[model samples]
Every structure is written in structure tokens, then in C-alpha cells.
Target: MPAQALGLPLLPPSKAKGKDFRRGVNMAITGGTAMNFSFYKSLGIENLVWNHGSLDTQIQWFKELLPSICGREQSCKGYVRKSLFMFGAYGGNDYNVQLLERGLTPEQAMNYTPKIVGAIANGVVKLIALGAVHVVVPGIFPTGCLPIFLPLFGDGDADLDDAGCLKAYNLLPPDQVPQLDAPEAGGSPPAEAPQLDEAHVRGLLRPRVPDGPGAPQVWV
Candidate 1:
């Protein structure tokens, strides 16, 4: 639960001396592709469509919910001006589809990354436009280090971290880690790995930043 409470009122768990206080209604939707469609479509899949939730559905949801929270008659009338918006942790669904459904190599799967990133970046911008002040977009996990990846591309000598994660597969560049340089007396290096980081995320999302002196500060 890597959470942040921004300008939100925190209340006691139980009533004290007949004084009752409670927190605001917090809305959280699933972000991945398995049960979510937004991530699935972004990964370049068009034929088989399935989604419990999508970005469009969420935006509409916020539109309806914001007015009630802000004490207004209608939706999104600047009521969400100071509300916290948690957007992502997306792109995993895209990666999953590429690797599992398409049966593509890591390198091949990553080629479709820009499309997914752009889609996520655009979603963040949409939230900003809707008056969401604090937005938090989570990063994806290291797929190569995931349990499913090892068996898919196992070479018997798969280099791993202390937790058995692939050493060759990480967020850092291959050149920076010596494990990717050469094979040791133990396991082999990873053939490929997804690069997930703040810099990379910000770089892709940068282009969508509003061209103004007072543009909102979005952290992904």
C-alpha cells in the first residue's frame, strides 16, 4: 500500500465523547489488463476485446462522483480541484499480452512499448484537464524477474537476484550491471527485460505537458 494522503482529512477509527469523524470516500479501480480492458487495448490487441474497466469508464465515473464530494449539483464543476487522483501501474497487461498471447520475445514485445506509454501519458493529461491536482501513476514490475518469465525463457543457468529474480533483467541499463556483461560459473544472463523507471516514464510523458508557464506538476 504505497499510498499518500493529500489534503485529506483523517479521522479517528471510533467515536470519542459522542463526536463522530470519518474520512472521505476513496475511489480505487483495478489497473491491470487481466480484469481491465484499457491496458489490453493499449498493447496492440484489437480482435479479442475484454475489459472489466477502462480509462473511459473511469473518467466518466469521476465525472459523476466528483460533484457529490465537492458538494455540487452536477459533476466535475471544479470540485476535484484539490482531490488526489491515482492513475496507473498500467502497461503490465500490454507486456503480458505480448509475451503470453502473442508468443513474442522480450525484445519483440518491447517494440510496442511506446504506444502503451503514450496511451498512459495521455490518460494522465486527461485527469489533469479534469482538475485533479495530485496524480500518482505507479510503475510496472520487472517482468524478466517475474516467476512466469523464468520458465518461458529459461536457459538452466538464469542469473537471479537474492529473491531469485533475474539479474540480467532489471530497471537499470545493461551496461551499468556487471552481471549482464559475461556469464559466470553459475546461472546465465537474461535474454531481455523491461526497463521501468521514473526517468523513462517522465521522458515519454513530457511531450504531453501543457505549453504554459503554470502547467500542473504531474508525478508518474
Candidate 2:
């Protein structure tokens, strides 16, 4: 039987004496911590695979390349009972792009986060259906710490998304730091806080998911 570590600690085989009891696969995403890699290796796992790059790339790679490799002649050729599958990453880069550059309001961003998360969860289920006996889907990191977020919220005052880079990025506290008094920060309120335009950014961060599965089609 094939075994997958999925970036988890390797466990000893049924038989000891340092003999490998089974074939193993290690799959990890880029930006995934080293601790995950170390944990798998320490358990004496040999085969390793990784997913690194943009979300689209990672998805494509998982759906295509990883499966192809695992099912190749050398990898799983003549085994009587063969199992092939993958472990996918947690988190995505779209929210950061939307918040920092596209200038989506938090409310708009929040609305999309759940959908994106749900899609990922469904992707995991699809992987399982595709002969993936085990799949590991990690969670998204707290995004308030991206370096790009620093200048966005420079004045330490709560900022609203005017659909402008300066506004949306500035809405989030830099480094996820608690909102604290910035000694001399100053910005005039524009007579009133602008109401969030829901429809404007809804399409930006999370494009309307297709009727089924394909590249995320953008309205524009």
C-alpha cells in the first residue's frame, strides 16, 4: 500500500530495524513553513513534491502534474493496488491583491473570503474523488501582516475603501497590530465616511465562480 505524509510527521512502520515499510509522498505548498517539511522527513519519507506559486498555478499543478507523476510508470507502474492523490495548499493571494491594490472595502472582501474558502474546500473534495486517498488542505494565514499593508494604513486611523489604493490598503492595520493611537496622524474626514460600494469590488477579488470549473472568468 502507498502512504502519504502530507507534511505531517512520519510514523514508524509495523516492522522496525529502520526498514522502510511503505512508499511515501510529500506534498507541500510554497510559503508553507519548513517545520512541515522537517516533520515529514524525520519520519523517513523519501518521495517529495511541492506546490509553489500563484493560486491558479497551484490548482492546475495539483489537477494535472502531480497526478501525472504519481501515476507514471516509474512511480506506480505495476503495483496490484495503487492509490494516487495530492495535498493542496491553504490560503490564496487574491485577497491581498484586492485589499492592497484593487481597493476593495473590508465588507466586500469579507463577503468573498467565505466563497473562496468554500471553493477550496470543494476542491479538496474533488481531489479525494480523483483517487486521492488523503488530501491535506491548510487554512489561510491572517493576511493583515503582508508588508504591503503597512503604507496602506499609514495614519493609524480607520480608513474606508474609496476603491482607491490609498483607501482600501489603509483600511487594515499594518502588521496586524492592534489599532492604537498614532501620535500625530491626521486626515480630514470627507464630510462623512463614504458608504461601501458592494458591487464595485465584488467582481474584483473573487470573480463570479463559473457555472462549474474553469479559469475564474472576470466580468471585465
Candidate 3:
């Protein structure tokens, strides 16, 4: 079963929480909630790469220079080289790609999101075939509640889960940028939560990115 489907907690109490540890390294997977961190640790992870915004930025940079990066690694003659097993929740920005650039309606961006999803799936499959073991793939959190999303939609009904972020707003139509960026123009107060528009709610359900740079090309 999928991790989420199996009903796993995002984070659990660590056995090392209260104990004094003088000589051990703890690899924390930071950006993530307690869910996968504890779960993966229980499965034997001592060092974490801190998978928060820092890692996300890394992934984004790599995606932008994918060809150069893949080539450099492949051509390198390293004494201890191993197949790079890369996995991530990629292509979550399709709606933004479509809405922001293509001038697609929020509804239209919804229709166009699956294209992005497929590309990410294909990339993952190729990585697996390349002999990657112990792969961990996580999906994007709700797009609607991103600081960009909440102020724009202003949907009070919207709520953030344990991660203090909404996974729902991420799905809004491409034109939703104004909604996502609405708080920026406001005089003050970072919008903690806002009511999402019908378009915003509808847009969050689907995911897609098209050819020619897709999500990575934007804001570049």
C-alpha cells in the first residue's frame, strides 16, 4: 500500500528524544513533517539531508540544468561512483506554468495539469531502471495554501494540515496567480488563511505541465 494509504503518521516520538546521546549522528529529513522522518528513521535512517525548502531549491536548480547535470555525473570518473537515484515530487507547478504564461483560464489549467504529472512519473521509472534502491518519493503539499495561494483566494474555509500549509490550493487554475499573489499588494498582514474561490478549489485537484521547460522554465 502507498505510505499515505497505509495510514502512517507524519511524525512519531523518537526513542532518542529524551536520552543523552554523546556519540551518534542523527540524519534528519527536516522539511518533512514527523510523518516520513520518524517512519523512515524507524526503517533505519541515521543522517537526514534536510528535505525542506533548501532541498526543494536544490531540486529546482537541478531540473533547470538537467542535461548538463546528468552529463557531468555520467562522465565523471569517480572511484566510488554509484548510480544517482533521484526521486521527488516534481511538476507541482504546472498550474502556475499554464496560468501564468499560457494565459489559460483557471479551469483550463486544470485540464492541462496531467501532462506534467506524466512526465514526472516517466522520469521516476527511468531512475528505477538505472539501479536505484531505497528510493523515497514525496508529493507536493496543497498548492492552495501557499502564501501565494491563500491571500489570492481569501478562502476562510481553507485550512492547513499538520504541516502548517495547505495541500489543496496547489491545484488551482493557472490564472490563479493573482489569487496566490494577492497578499503581496495588501497593506499589511500576511494572510494566514483565506477563502478559496471556486476556481481555486477546482484547479487544485489536477496536476499538469506541458512541453518546453514546463514548470521549471517559469520564474527563471
Candidate 4:
């Protein structure tokens, strides 16, 4: 469904001033990563990172805007509590940077999944600390089904699954997949805040796929 359909219109970019954020704000940037460029620098691949707008950077932007969004600490807490926070489907670009730019195989890229997930979890914890009561942190989509990966990673007929996706890359590692659902920062979410995952997102996007050859497939 469209953001407006859910009553959450597309958030304006951080730089968009004089606009109302009574709905929300968007800090995401194209080519952003879950892990910062410094992390990539540690791996000796920082040169491949074209955009420095990592999750941390976006969070900082939110922090800078928080005071203006809600004045007093107590009022800000209430504003944050009532608002829904949508964290991410984050790790995609983190892996993309490595797979497409640094030339790593899917399996090799999987090695960073844990760290990437940790970073997202940490971001959620930060949101909760800032008084978020309803935060939805979504998982990455099935990578193999993505159009970009299909052409670049497919090697032979055997690599394609019955559904026509690259079989090996269709799913995340079982252990890594559940880590996103585990307690945030080692504790359960606030009692008022229900834990949510990607399933909720899939349900929203699934119904919007039109039936036709030209219809765009919704990947969640």
C-alpha cells in the first residue's frame, strides 16, 4: 500500500524546511548503508563507499531535528511515544556495497550480516531511548529475486530456483535471520511497544501487486 493509504505520507527529506513533520521525517539517502564508511574503511573497502549517509548519520540527523519537532523533554517524549517509527530494511545496501562494488560473492557478503544486524538493532535501541513506543524494524528482502542481482549473480540454469530466483541467495542464513527479532540491546521492547518484524511489511506490500505482465513485483 502507498504511504498515504496508511495515513503516513512520504516523509520529506531532512533538508526540506518549513514543512510539517507532524506526520514524520525521512533521513534515508540513496546508497546509504547500515554500517558507516569508517567500518568499510577498516575492511579496506572505504573507497567503494560513494555515499557516507550511514544509519548512524541518519540517526544523528534525526537527533538534530528532535528538539525542533518537540520542544520540552516531556513533550518530546509524548510526541515520540505516539508516533510510529519505521527503522529499516537496512542490510541490503551494506551488502550491495561489498557485492557490487568490492566484488564479493554472496557467501562472502553474508559474513558481515551479523555486524549489520547489530547496527540496526542498536539504532532501534536508540529510538526506544528517545521515547518511541511503536517501532517497526524490517528485514531485508529476498536478495536473489531482486532484478539487479539476478543478472549480475546468475551463473547457470542450476543457480535459478523453480521460482526463477537465484536459489543460494534467496534466503538469509537461518541463525542471522532471527537475530533481528531477538531482544533489543539485550532487553525486551517496552511493554507498550509490541515487537514487529518483516512479516507485517510483506502483508502490506503483497496486496498492492497488480496482476499483469507489466505489473511491478513488490519485494519486501
Candidate 5:
């Protein structure tokens, strides 16, 4: 399906009261990271992450709103089972913070990929504990292909790939991809989960390229 058909409209801010969530609510925040600020702080990285809407924060918000969204523990379980959860495209900004603010090279930034992916896996486990049956956890996209990265990192022909995307920046390692098939991350999500294939999800999440001359190029 198209990205627009994913679900309901933008949810009100976490502090907003009495908002409708019957359809669904978007908890995603701009500049949100998988790991919290404290995680970076422990590593002596300061003044890097500006927005504090980390994954843990958003999940906490969901826990608080659950009562209003569905009453009673039993009912909440049913509500969650029937609902679709889109976990993330996290780790993008996690790397960005290291690269842009901490002055780490892309390779150096990749050293934290395991931890970043682990954080997202932990999030999926949380949703599963909350009775989430079908959680769609999207992996990070090709950073080099991003328009923002293209201009910022591109230097010369040596840096560009055959497709003109920066070779160094498009470093989404194979192992870093979230594996829902793992037993810990809900173990293949049962038979009832939405049967979204790899190609379909990729198409939905792919950065939009311009169709024709003067056509707008939209990025996800």
C-alpha cells in the first residue's frame, strides 16, 4: 500500500488531552532516536541530541495513554492484538548525531550499529510484552541515496557509486537489519500478522524520486 494509506493522521503531541485515537495515533517525533540521550551522555558525547523524544520516551507515552485508548488490562490486550504496530526506521539519526555532531566518520559511526539495532529489537520485545501481535519494524534506508546526504558527503567521482550515490555513506550493514524472524523479536510474528513482503515494504519506505522534469523529489 501507499504510505498515505498506512493509517490515521498525525497524532496530537504527547501532552495533548482528549484526542481521538480510535483509528490510531502516530507517536513518532522529528529527530527521535532509538537510544535515549543518556546513552550518548554516558559515552561522553554532549550537546549532540537536541530532541529528547527517544524510543523509550515514546513507548512510555504509549504506556500512559493505553488506559485512555483502551480500558482494563484484558481489553488492552485485545486492542493491541488487533492493532498494527510500526516500530521504526530508527538508527538513522542515531548515526547522524555521531557523524554530524560528534565528528565521527561513517565507518566509526557504524561501530555502534549493533547497539542501535539491539535497542530497536528491545522495543519490539516491549511491544510484544504489551500484546502487540503484528509489529512492522522497518530498517534504516540507504543514507547515501538520501538527497541531504548526497550534497553533504559527495565530493568527486571516486566517492560516488555507479548510481551516483556516495559509496562511503551508504553503509547499512547486512547484520544491522532488524530480524523479526528471531525468536526474541516475536519469532516470525505468527501466521495472523500482516503478510508484508520485503519488496512491498521497500516500495512503501523508498525515498521518492522525481518522475519527470520539474517533478518534486520527495524523501521519506
Candidate 6:
């Protein structure tokens, strides 16, 4: 989700709708799909930081955007605080962590489900306190239907359900987990248990930055 990647096809603001928002030479045009590009044009995002990492790493990425939230004067561009925060589709990595790293059974990972939900909830609360007026938390997808889980957890055709997915692995839809806490803000889920005022650091969030500047931080 880099700025150049988004803006290039989006046609800046001027080229898309005949209204120029800034003064600059147009680089490329994406044909007559201008109307569909409206949302990206109006987003007015200055920077975008993205990477393939677990939920914890995503949180750190959010913090990296923190300084820009308040603007560092002559140093950094200013982005309003608490404007809109989008996080997650997490817990996928939780499964990966348990199966790949922890060597825990699916049931054991399921048992740890509550903590995972709690961490998400805590992250939401923390973001709100930090400066997020609106937070968007998306639910995880059904791993049972995914190709990865079918072979890893399934046992031949007997394990396949109506959709040819693994029934043994899919206890409940991944989206049905306890978290879906805040439906108001784009269906972001919450934690299972009440988290301490800490940043709800557990699972992935805990291992990376357990100590130092934001040590033992819990969001809500």
C-alpha cells in the first residue's frame, strides 16, 4: 500500500475528476475508470507503511505513524490524530504461530483463542486512547475453507465437508471468534477477557517489544 502504488493508478485528484487538488505534472492515466477511483482520490493520505508481518508487527507499524499523527513541526508532515484507524484480520498468524512455531495442536490453539481476542480488544482501546477517533477491526477468515488447513489438518475425504473444506479443523468460522467487539467501527472484534490498562500485549505483540520505551504496555 505504498503512496506511489496507490496514486499512480488513481490519477492524483485532478486527472480523475477534472478538479486539480495540487500543482504537479501528471505521470500516468488509468483510462475511463475515473469514477471508481473517487475514494482513493479523496483519501488524502500522505504516507502508507505496510509489510507482511503478524498482528504485533502491524501494531509497531501503527506506532511508527504516531509521530506523523501530531506532526513534528519542521521535521515531519502532520496527520490529524484519531482520524481513522484500520487494523487487523489478525489471528491467522496466531494459528501459524501455534502450528509452525509452538508445535501446539489445533485444540491447544483454540484454547488460547480467548487471549488472542483479548489482544485485539486491547489494541483497539489503545489506539482510541492514543488518537484514533474511528477504528476499523476486521475479522479473520474461515481457515477451514482455506487450502492450507485442508491438508494440514484434514484426514482424507472423510474430513471434507460440503464445501470440500476440513471440518475437523474448522470448529467455528474464524470470523465467529469472540473478538468482533466493535461492530460500529467496521466490525473490528474485541478481546475475550477484560484486559488490564496495559496495551494488551500478548502473543505476537508481546514477543517483539516486551520491554524498552513502551515496555509492558497495555492499550486499555
The best candidate by lDDT is: 4
Candidate 2 lDDT for residue 16: 38
lDDT of 3: 0.37
Candidate RMSDs in order: 11.0, 16.7, 16.7, 10.1, 10.7, 14.8
Please list the residue runs of candidate 3 whose C-alpha ends up more than 4 Å from where it truly belongs after superposition. 1-86, 103-106, 155-220
Which pairs clash in model 4? none
Report the lDDT tens digits of candidate 5 across residue range 1-220.
4555986366566566787886688788888998888888887767744466789888988988899889999999889878887777777888888877787878888677646655665666566677775667666777778887777777888999999888888874332333233443323322222222232222322222224553322221
Q: How many clashes show up per model?
A: 2, 1, 34, 0, 0, 16
The better-scoring model by TM-score among 2 and 6 is 6
In candidate 2, which residue ranges exceed 4 Å CA deviation? 1-57, 66-68, 72-89, 157-220
Deviation in angstroms for 111 in model 1?
0.8
Q: For each candidate, give its TM-score against the true structure.
A: 0.62, 0.40, 0.35, 0.75, 0.72, 0.49
What would the per-residue lDDT of candidate 3 be over residues 1-220, giving only the tens digit for each residue? 3636887423321223553322211222334321223433453544454224233343333333333323444442221023233244444444444444455555665554333433333343333333333234455545655676555544454455555554444444233233332222212212332233322222321122222431111110
Give a tens-digit lDDT track for model 1, residues 1-220: 2233465454322213443322334333443341245455565656453354555555566566554445554344355555555565666766667767777766666565555555566567677777666677877777767787787666755466677766544432111212121222012233442244334445544555554654666776
Ranking by TM-score: 4, 5, 1, 6, 2, 3
The weakest ten consecutive residues by lDDT in model 3 span 211-220
| Cα lDDT of model 6 by residue, 50-85, tens digit | 122334444554455445334463232223231434
What C-alpha lDDT, on a 0 to 100 scale, does residue 46 get in candidate 3?
A: 41
Displacement of the residue 133 alpha carbon in candidate 3, Å: 3.1
Candidate 3's displacement at residue 220, Å, is 28
Q: lDDT score, residue 143, model 4?
A: 76
lDDT of each: 0.53, 0.37, 0.37, 0.66, 0.66, 0.44
Total backbone collisions, model 5: 0
For candidate 6, the per-residue lDDT at 143 reads 62
* Model 4: per-residue Cα lDDT over 67-163, one tens digit each: 8889888998888878777787687888777777788777787666656755766666566667775666667777788899888889888999898
Q: Candidate 1 or 3, higher lDDT?
A: 1
